[model samples]
Target: MPFALYLLGLAVFAMGTSEFMLSGLIPDIASDLRVSVPAAGALTSAFAAGMIVGAPLTAALSMRWPRRRALLAFLVSFLLLHVLGAVTTSFEVLLATRFAGAVANAGFLAVAVATAAAMAPPEAKGRATSILLGGVTLACVAGVPAGAVLGTMWGWRSAFWAVALLSVPAVVAVLRSVPATPAPTGGGGGARREARALRDPRLLMLLVLAALVNGATFCTFTYLAPLATSVGGIAPGWVPGLLVLFGLGSFAGVTAAGRLADTRPRPLLAAGGVALVAGWAVLGAAAGSPVAVAVLVLTQGALSFAVGSTLVSQVLYAATQAPTLAGSFATAAFNVGAAAGPWLGGITIGAGLGYRSPVWVSASLVAAALAVAATAHVTGRGPTSPDASRLQQTLP
Candidate 1:
């Protein structure tokens, strides 16, 4: 892989850390701001909301600009927003900063995926995407925990400051390593072009697939801390360690999936879906068993991310006519799922279903995605080989 790909991953790491660290800081934020925990938790929802809007909006706005310049602009905004977050005194100000930061993060991610796809050999596009997204999984493994520790020792603001500092190096890396490529020619109005590109049924199916799969994963993931403590009878102190284990599994899954993505994405997708369903089932059944909970967290994380990168690759392949917009839509779809999962899980908990209820909810969503994948395969609309897709796109 190119060094630029790794730099993109580093950029993702900074963004992912900022995006996720808020979960750990909610309690502190609630206390410091004199608000309810749920209100502080809304900060997370605010960020996701920003992402849902920003991805497509940014993609459309930047459609005519060089990818490198768009990416750099987004990073500059991202860095500044984190600084704003660090300095904000009022909860409302902090929430606004989080939303702004997410907008920048969404733009950065959408462009990064498109740029990575453009940079890689067609045969290696999947691996290239994996390399770029690996930063996210790495954040889960390393950055979130470290931010939590930093926040606990100093203050929540410290974590934002750290992310701001991290973005400085990421900006430098992109300026040095990533080349500026001109936007594609023969463009109609950007909005019309993107709208027309989204008309493809295969692309739409892939977007739905992204949403369902991501929703399934987050349904369980958003409640893991409570489930670990209340259901598995684990100590609260052990929650962070369990999250690290989950991250390690995710890292391993994405790495392995990248190796097979170019040639065997369909099988990989099917297998990942099945594995996720099975993992959730086992987790629900063994919710009270600490050993089983630990094992299943790791298993679920691996299966979830294995499906994630493959889904992104499939969307990119299907959206050859509008790669950047497709990338934005995929990001938006994933955030939609991310936001929906926790809300649904919260409803289940409110209705008196135990914390383990999220496991079943996730399983059902993944099963739906599996059914869609099967339908696509049976109907001959599954992702094509990269070489074949390129040939088809080139034909008059």
Candidate 2:
């Protein structure tokens, strides 16, 4: 991979670490900041709220700017946002800081995807995108864990300090390596292409499917630790180790997406949805057995994330126009699902159900996502089996 591409990937890695490490440090943060844990919880939700609103919104507003300037400015925004978060005094200030951080985070992803695709050889786009996204899996595998340790050692502030430090080099590298690209034109092929993409009903269906699966996954995943420790008989020491296993599975899936994303997406996406159903089923059944729970969680992470690379490609390729809009909008749809999943999971857990209750409910959610995904192919409205050589053929 080109050095520039890797830099973009590292930026993503830093963002991913900053985003995910919050979960591991929430208690420490609450204790140090003298806030209720529930209040700390709201901070995470607030950040997700920022991503939901910021992804497409930020991209749309920045459409007229040169891509390089847009990217660098956002990197600077990311640095300032986290630095503020690290130094905040009042709980409210920290919350606001994290919200800004999320906006920067989402904007970065939207731009990075476009940047990676633009940077790639037409045929190598899949690989370029995969490398970009791998930074995310890297965060999961190592960054979050490291941050967790940092938080345990020095405090939650140090974790933010770590993110601030890591991001400096990433911003510098992106500025050094990524080439200049023209501001997105308001007319020409891009406009026409965007219009065409919007005409696809399958894309809408895929969005719905994503929302459902994300809801299910987050519902279960967000509460997994408490469940495993309280009811699944897992030792407390095993939590991060088990999470590491899940991350390994997630990384493997992401790496595999580069090859599979190019060859075909509909089958892979659908298959992943089906695998999600199976994985959730395993979780619900194995909740009481530590070994079984670990195995199921690993399977869940592996199977569900296997299509990470393909999901974006499918959305982008679903229409021939406005790739930037399509890409960012797809990211928006994902945020919607993410937002809904946690809400629904919270409701389920709040209803006097044990941690295991959400597992089955989550399975049902994944099942719905799978059904919609399969329906997309059946109705000819979702991701199709892309023939890399058949671009000249008329799209249905």
Candidate 3:
């Protein structure tokens, strides 16, 4: 793999940190801004909303720009937005900055995936893509906690300042390391091409699968604190440790998936889906057992992330003409699932279903994803194309 791949991963780390660090800062932000916690929480929703709108829109607009230039622009935008977010005293200003930051984040990720795919050999595309995405998993394992600690020790603004400072190096790295590559051909009709790519059954199926898989994971994850305390009988103090276990599992899973994806992607995806379903089912039944719940949380995290790199690789494969746009769509789908999972889980809890109900809800979501994966396999379609090898050689 090229060193630039790791730099791209570094960029993603900064973005992922910005995306998740807000979770830890919300209480402080609410306290300082004199807003309700729920209102502070809406900032997260605003960021997701920006991502959902920005991904496809940015990808489409930047379709004609050089990959390296586009990436640098996005990184700079991300860095500045974090600075803006850090200095803002008004909650409304912070919210707007976060939304803009998310747009930059989405643009950066879409281009990064496309660039990685273009640079790797056909057989190693999955591994290459995973290398870039590993930063996000690493952020979950390390960055979020660190941000929370920073916020606790200093103030919420300190966390944002840290992210802004971290992003400076990422911007410099991208400008220095990433090589310029020409945009894909067919610029005049890029929008039409991307729109048509959305109509492909295989691409659509993959997007749906991506959404469901992410949704299933977040459904349980969003309520992990409550479940751990109320159902598993675990002490509040142990919850963070359990979350660390889950993050570590996710890091390991994505790493291993990158290696297996090239040789056995179908089986790998299928197994991940099955494992998620089984993990959730077991957790739902054994919710009262701390050991069982702990083990299942780790298992679910591994299975959930194991397939993430492959999902991006498949999107690139399926939408050969519109790879970046397809990738943006996948990002949007994941966000949609992320949003929906929590909403649905909240409904289940509101209806007097026990905290454990999220386990079943997540299981059903993954089960649906598994069914879609099966259908995709039966259709005998794959992401590979005759031009893939040639494109890899041409990438910077």
Q: Which one wins on TM-score?
A: 1
Candidate 3 TM-score, true structure as reference: 0.94
Alpha carbon lDDT at 205, candidate 1: 84
Candidate 2 lDDT, tens digit per residue, 4-35? 98889899999989878887998888888898
| Candidate 1 global CA lDDT score | 0.87
Q: For each candidate, what is the lDDT?
A: 0.87, 0.76, 0.83
Better of 2 and 3 by lDDT: 3
For model 1, give the 10-residue run with minimal summed lDDT: 386-395
Compared to the true structure, candidate 2 yields what TM-score?
Answer: 0.93
lDDT of 1 by residue, 26-143 (tens): 9999998899999999999999999999998887777878888999999999999889878878999998988888998999999899899888987777898789779999999999
Which candidate order results from sorting by TM-score in descending order?
1, 3, 2
After superposing candidate 1 on the true structure, give the runs of residues whose Cα lies further than 4 Å from its correct spot.
186-188, 386-396
TM-score of each: 0.96, 0.93, 0.94
